[model samples]
Target: MKKRSIIGLTMGGLMLIAALCTKAVTPTLRLSDTRPKIILGTAIPTKFGDWQEDASQVAAVVNPTTVAELNKIYAETLSRTYVNRQGNRIMLSIAYGTDQRDNLSVHFPEGCYGGQGFAVGQTSQVVLPTVAGGIATSRTVATLNSRVEPITYWVVVGDKAVPNSWEVKKVKLAYALQGMIPDATLMRVSSIGEDIEQGYQLQQSFIDQLLQSMPPDLRGHFSGTSH
Candidate 1:
């Protein structure tokens, strides 16, 4: 009986040591101080290339209810209306979250548009060829009554442009494993026009020109790459 007790005590002590060692080696999934915080307003250029901000038309793109929901999720949101010399207009909306956990992830455009009574159609993932490289993004045409808006957007998870929910989770997990909480930003650009193709072309042009016009360091906030 005494020998059995000694063996049991040795096993218990070994288990306690193993538990303490694991507690030390295992990384806690916590926010790392090394990650940089991105400020949306300052990071994005107001007047870039041929596009200039139209302050008065800001309210025409997004409704109140959607804005209210956005306020809840995003740490900072920027909504701007830009028009070029050719009279083409693009609405730019960027939402950033410091903590991109499952509960605080971005509210993607399809759901937001659906909530606003817009029918989402022609949804597909596209690789946008930028100066940095090919960045993955999603495009969709949303319709409501007489209005048709084509949107081209991407979500940056950590420093990568994630195309869909799966990629978002993958990237987030990658960061979490490194003991860091990742930040995310949803960069969206849309134009109102009946021709979805033309709208997309214009939105792409706007994005390209905007990226080119921005300072080198600031471009990564939109493009999700250092280049």
Candidate 2:
């Protein structure tokens, strides 16, 4: 009986120590509180390269997410429509959240469009070339009746950018392991057209120009800094 008691006590002590270690290493630091805040309105230009804000079409680029839900999850959201010299218009939506831990993950366009009765197509991955390097992003098509929308998007966690929705959680966990909770930004650009290929080309052009237009640090915020 004495030997059994000693073994039981040792096991209990080991479990207690393990729990304490876990509690100690668990992330409590919030990088959002220290990092510079992203102001969506000014971060993206209203005019860059050959494109300018199509103010008349801005009202059409509405998010399916309700205002209350957006307020609960996002720190800031920007929605606009821009037209290039060729009259091609692209809808831009950006959502930034200070904390992506728990239920605050940025609402992806795939889910938002699904909620709005659009049939979402398979998503394709693309790597956009930038001065900082290549930014991995996802492109997909959503169709509803006569309207077909092709969207390209990426998520920025801390200084890292990821295109996959599942990868966002991985990035968050990596940050948590370092005892820091990283902020996240979701930037989506879509255009209404049946020719998905052409739509994507226009979007890539707009995105490249838009990133180039921003100051280096601001550009780094979205595409990351490491060349």
Candidate 3:
């Protein structure tokens, strides 16, 4: 009986120590935990070429008037996160009716290792493509990425509403930028480039097309104009 009791006590003690050690091994923050899914947001690993290309192409087709307006109206962005096996991170930022102040932005920062983030920093200027002197212009300030934890995103929307149904325009891009971050030289290029403003110009064009497609009656709602 004495020998059996000693064995039982030893087993119990070992089990308790093992449990405590297991708890200590667990990460404090578990940065590896998958980020929450957002309605209009998605994350893609860097290896996938189509991901960045598709996004840039979309931005190219849709044009916003000015860099400011482009930033405000439409931008699918990812920040502070590296690419996983899938593709570059992607998130859509759009206002429902015309509420700019209470906008929502999604961030996927979990998988970033290094050299992963917004292609253009806050200071960088992105000039959108343009056909000519066209639609109205407006500006709003917003952030797309943050260096801290939990990831951060800034989606800017103004009190602008779309009048008609959603209009999608597919414009052929002579050149387009893939991934959120561009190379060093591209970053320095002006929004009003010698011929084209890489990121800004293309996105602006689509914004204009989207606005024009809106039903003539609904146009006023997004422009913050009353007919």
lDDT of each: 0.82, 0.87, 0.27
| Top-lDDT structure, candidate number | 2
Instruction: List clashing residue pairs in candidate 2.
Output: none
Backbone clash numbers for all candidates listed: 0, 0, 27
Candidate 2 per-residue lDDT over residues 82-179, each given as its tens digit: 99878899999998889888678888888999998999999889898766678989999999999999999999888888988788878888888888
Using TM-score as the measure, the top candidate is 2
Candidate 1 per-residue lDDT, tens place, 105-187, comes to: 88788888988899998679999987766789999988999999999989987788977778898888777767677778888
Give per-model TM-scores: 0.83, 0.90, 0.25
lDDT accuracy of residue 149 in candidate 3: 15
For model 2, state the Cα shift of residue 112 in Å: 0.9
Model 3 stretches with alpha carbons more than 4 Å out: 1-92, 97-120, 123-196
Q: Where is model 1 more than 4 Å wrong at Cα?
A: 1-36, 63-68
Q: Candidate 3 residues 1-227, lDDT tens each?
A: 99999999999999999998655543233111222222223222222322232443333111213345435532332221222234423222232211111131211112111223323322222222223222233222222244221111111112121111111101001001111110000000011122222324433433444335444433333333332
- Model 2 whole-model lDDT (C-alpha atoms): 0.87
- Candidate 3 TM-score versus the reference: 0.25
Better of 1 and 2 by lDDT: 2
